[model samples]
Target: MGLLSNRQRSNLIKSYLYILPAFLFLLIFTYYPIFYAIFISFFRWSTDYPQKVFAGVQNYVEILKGDLFWKVAWNTLLYSVSTIFISMALGLFLAVQINKKVRASGVFKVALFYPMMIPLAAAALIWLWIYIPTYGLLDHLLSGLGLPTLPWLNSTETALWCIVAVGVWKHVGYYMILFLAGLYNVPSELLDAATVEGAGGFHRFWRITFPLLSSYTFFVFIINIVDSLQSIDLVYIMTQGRPADATNLMVYYIYQQAFRYWNMGVGSTLTSMLTIFLLICVAVIFSTIGRRIYYEV
Candidate 1:
């Protein structure tokens, strides 16, 4: 091909210029911090040690040797698994229910999605009140019904689960919207033919609708896992990884190490570990489940 004319060259430069700001943002804010954290992971940098004394994987070894790290890892896994399944299930259910010809469906949608509109910290505070032992709304309702009242967030057995509930509540509506969009995109012709063939509602949904929604389901599943893994706001505001560290997660552990304890090396090591784990998860998911997703051509 011939070289570009002056107008074409000018247009190409303008296009690059249009994208320059966003490129710089990603380079500085995203990529730079990742590399910086990796670089910091090698050193013994803390409040006690102002100078960066190279520790060379000693931080990683320290974290791996600690019992608290394993406890936090298990907690993170439990929270992620519970939140991912519950949120996706509830979201799919709500989307299907609201997709029907129900009256005032839009109002129901808004009511469910309202939690997402609220800031997460504000939502945590709301749940905090709701979980306040016998004086909270939840306990009050249980007591009115002659049921037992238990401390939700102040107990080790229930604290992490309570946070998982919050995670599900906060993000389920967003997932519902995604599933709803997918439902809309399912080919009407296929459903009509299935109906004409005497396929029951459940059968139609199982055979046609669900299969067509595979791509959306996969996307939502990946998003839920990532969100669960990264979530720390509720843990920070409500529990602070307390009640014997029952609600402690990887991200909060990193925060505690870096800020509360001023252990920069350990914090960076934890950050790198989390990032690597997330990458592996995405890679495994894409290689396995992603290949099986159904697409409408």
Candidate 2:
């Protein structure tokens, strides 16, 4: 039985039509590729289909057995952990400082946020020049101070750290914005009450503000980890996993396996592994640290 009038049915259809394009776009581009990658992981694909040789779990075995896989896995974790902690520390510091009422606060915000707007490739190029031997900014300063000018991006020991610094610098601003928003949400009454109790700045921040900001901190932590895991552009542009693969990350390694070396099956296996790894990480985070966060007043 047709119960609804023509106008009501038309509005309902239009609402569904509005969301249909976005639904289809994600289905085709994101979901399909993910599922297909998992499907191909069990085969020996060489960038061609139908002729792909079936090799169940062998690609996973090969990638895990290879020394390169473990090396990049460690590098990925190192980069992610280093960048996330440093960036969050800097971001939280900046957010707290900037949240105070000051004359030049707007200018400081803009200056800090500017770096995040720069394209990663472009930023890598600029940093490449800065890290250039002898005449570069860093080495020039070191030389001027009569200190040893170490290789920035050339040495294995420092190459990953250099990239980590770049990542921290680029990402700290975005995280600062997130923390700033959370800071604003901290209850003014609570702070005022703490103030009346003769609570000092550090006491108030540690006891009240930081606890309220746990949600934002958790979000920034997860995002930084995920982004670092998928970091490829800067590595591709700056290091290309050079200096003995010190800066090699998992995503770049996957790209190399799939495109450069044309090991499609191995690439697919890596892709699946990365997905599962991220899922497990997220689950563990929610089960552990996420339980401590308070979202409600």
Candidate 3:
């Protein structure tokens, strides 16, 4: 009995030792940074004044008063909603198509997924060339077809949509894969039963496949919204929030405030606000929509 207890204790110690690194990593990188940001949000700190001086809600007040704050917030909302809707629609379409045992399905899958493998910076750079007003490929093609050249990234009217297009182009494949996995797991018996009842393709999809894929759809919605809110790399590289900050997103604005203007206090406050907003969104999604998502055995 003593020998067995000693062996069990040894195994327990080894298990904890294996998990210690990961626990420490999360603490140092994730929780530590979050707590630090929260603490700094209440202060007025800068390189000039390295010591943090508590300013209560002044940082938050400054953010609320800024005109750019509301503008960026609206821009983020527009970007997030548009991206989620479009991406989910396109992803579902592609998932349904590819799920059909069609010829060259493997090749189609690879081609669709190729964009996701490329780095965001590289993708943005490529899109920047494509969106160039005068000498871009799009312009030349439009001119050949007798259509007017568009100022895709130059005009305030089209800049946000242009970014959304690029985001969709990059992300649709990822969500398509998720939807495809869900589709594959759906029981064919349910589909066949629906078909036998004389349900047409659209009706069957709406009633059966959609309900069964609810969990995946919900997951994709949450992930896409989060990605849209945090979107910066493509916008930074392509538009730089150009045309009078028309394309300015929350994260990009946060980066500018924290790094460009060196307003750490305000930046921290913005970060806290973003974190809170994201948490609220997640909470709402899980509490309300999550209950509706179906999980098949």
lDDT by residue for model 1 over 1-297, one digit each (tens)? 159998999999999999999999999998899889999999999998999999998998999999999999999999999999999999999999999968999998998898999998899999999999999999999999999998999899998999999889999999999999999998889999999999999999999999899999999999888888998899999999999999999999999999999999999999999998999999999999999999762
Off by over 4 Å in 2: 1-18, 47-50
Count of backbone clashes, every candidate in sequence: 0, 0, 0
Worst 10 residues of 1 by lDDT: 1-10
Taking all chains together, each candidate's TM-score versus the true structure is 0.94, 0.92, 0.93
Worst 10-residue lDDT window for candidate 2 reads: 45-54
lDDT of 2 by residue, 1-297 (tens): 299899999999999999999999999998999999999999998855537999999999988899999999999999988888899999999999999977799999999998999998899999999999899999999999999998999999999999999998898999999999999999899999999999999999999999999999999999988898899988999999998989899999999989998888989999999999999999999999999999975
- State the local distance difference test value for candidate 3: 0.91
How well is each residue in 1-297 modelled by candidate 3, as lDDT tens digits? Answer: 466688798998899999999999999998898889989999998776578889999999989998999999999899989999999999999999999899999998999999999998999989999999978988879988998999989999999999999999999999999999999988999899989999999998999899989988988988887899999987788877888889999999989989988889988999999998999989998999898778763
| lDDT (CA) per prediction | 0.93, 0.93, 0.91
Better of 2 and 3 by TM-score: 3
